[model samples]
Target: MNLAEKIDKILANEVPFLEVAIYYLDFTVYFANLLFPLFLFLSVIWFTSKLANNTEIIAFLSSGVSYYRFLRPYMIGATIVCIGAFFLGMYLAPIASQGFNDFTYKHLKKGKKAYENTNVYRQLNENQYLYVGYFNVTEKTGTNFTLEEFDGPKMVNKISANRIQFNEADSTYTLFKYKERRVGEFGDELISEAKRDTIFDFDLDDLTPVKYIAETLNLNELNDFIAREKEKGSSYISRYEVVRYKRWSLPVSAYILTIIAVAVSSVKRRGGMGVNLAIGIAIGMVFIFFDKIFGTLAEQSDFSPFIATWAPNMVFAVLAIYLLRNAKR
Candidate 1:
């Protein structure tokens, strides 16, 4: 459906074909990063269940192979998959995530509904602060913008504009209906102008930035971004922290899911492979549900991002251990 919608847009010339193709590639990478662990779990369950059904597992056991010895190959396979997933989360997926979101906002949606942070408040530095009531990224404009400068908790100067626009050609900001107030030792000096062009220390990108911008950065970049956001006391820092912790959590989940899948499918039963697959799918869905719930909590509430990211893995790891113990008998 997503592809079809993009294709329709392409046919209507609403979006460029090359852009859609690039978005499609990026989307594929992002989806693979999310689903590969689940797919590997299912694959292990299917393959091992087949072996069990064919009596191959029984034959091996009868030939004096311990269950622990039998698990060595599966653990080795999981280790390989875990390493791949780590690379995807740490490096490749971030690049794809950046491209995917960029295309979605810039071309596919045309920046119609892309601004999540409509009213932005940020302390640019110890002395400078910025506020924007509304920011239109497509037009590179902000409405009801105000910037204040302070010196040791004392307000020094303030600039207010009805509208501010970013000029790409000259890389400057043009403030319309601008007003400025400067605090003097004697009194306050006020100035008003119809329009003013001034260069600010910040750019349009600093205004109402995307919440998931951290997801687009590699590990090193993400760490730096989080640090910067923390220094600025950004409310969205939790969202960034969630993404950072999730990179490690996702790779660890592969081993947990693998153990659960193997334990649930190691025994041959009346319904054969389908039963195992059904159970595996159900578990996968539940795991996803837990992950999403905790992730949202971290993003929207004051939940600890580290705990939110790893909660599902921790819960399921215990389940995997219990199931593995039962299966060993």
Candidate 2:
């Protein structure tokens, strides 16, 4: 459905076939990797429901196989999936995400800003701090800029400007209405100018990350990126941390969802496979619901990302335990 829509869009836009093919490949891989575990859960339910209907599960337990023993193979399989999912999400999905998002923005959503960070603040180092009221990534400019330097809590110098623009060609800044104050033993010396060009301790591109930048980096790169963003007092730190934590949580969810599927479908019911399938679908939707709700809360508010990332799994784990116990009986 999405492919068809994108195809129509690209055709109307006259986007090239090569770009479309690349987008299609990356688009398919990214979402498939993301939803692989959920699909695996339904597959498990289908297979187990069939086994139960055929009386194979009953025979295994009736012939002195412990329920735990019957579940051993499933657990082993889940472990393999867990590891595979971890590597794919950590290493490969980011590349696919980069391709997918890059194409989306460049062609599908051209001229639109992903988002802008306002009232941005950064601790350049122990001694230097910076602030900007608003920044433009494309223009490489900011308004109401301030940079302050201190030595052991005592102020050294402060610079303020009405507008600042980065000169990428020469690696300097052009400040409008520039003013500087230098704190000295005798007194503070003020320097004022209408316009000035100078260099700073930072680069504009380094200070401001591009949108969807977090989704394009591998694990190590992401960790380092988050550390820098934290020091910079980024308002979207929660969003970045959510992505990082989900990298770890995705694999763990593979096992949790698999166990739930087995427990839910390992018994024959009056309505047969369809009943188990309907139940499985409901459970999957509920899992997605909790995941999205908590994830949004963390991203949009001060909610803890850790709890948001894992809470759904924790809730479903308890449910899995309850269902497994019942199935055992």
- Please give the TM-score that candidate 2 achieves against the real structure: 0.93
The digit string of per-residue lDDT tens for model 1 on 2-46 reads: 876677656665676677788889999998888887899899999
lDDT for each residue of candidate 2 in 40-104, tens digit (9 for 90 to 100): 89999999999999999999999998999999999899898888888888999999999998888
TM-scores for all candidates: the values are 0.93, 0.93
**Model 2 lowest lDDT segment of ten:** 203-212
Question: Which 10-residue window of candidate 1 scores lowest in summed lDDT?
Answer: 108-117
Best by TM-score: 1
lDDT at residue 137 of model 1 (Cα atoms): 72
Off by over 4 Å in 2: none
Quality of model 2 by C-alpha lDDT: 0.88
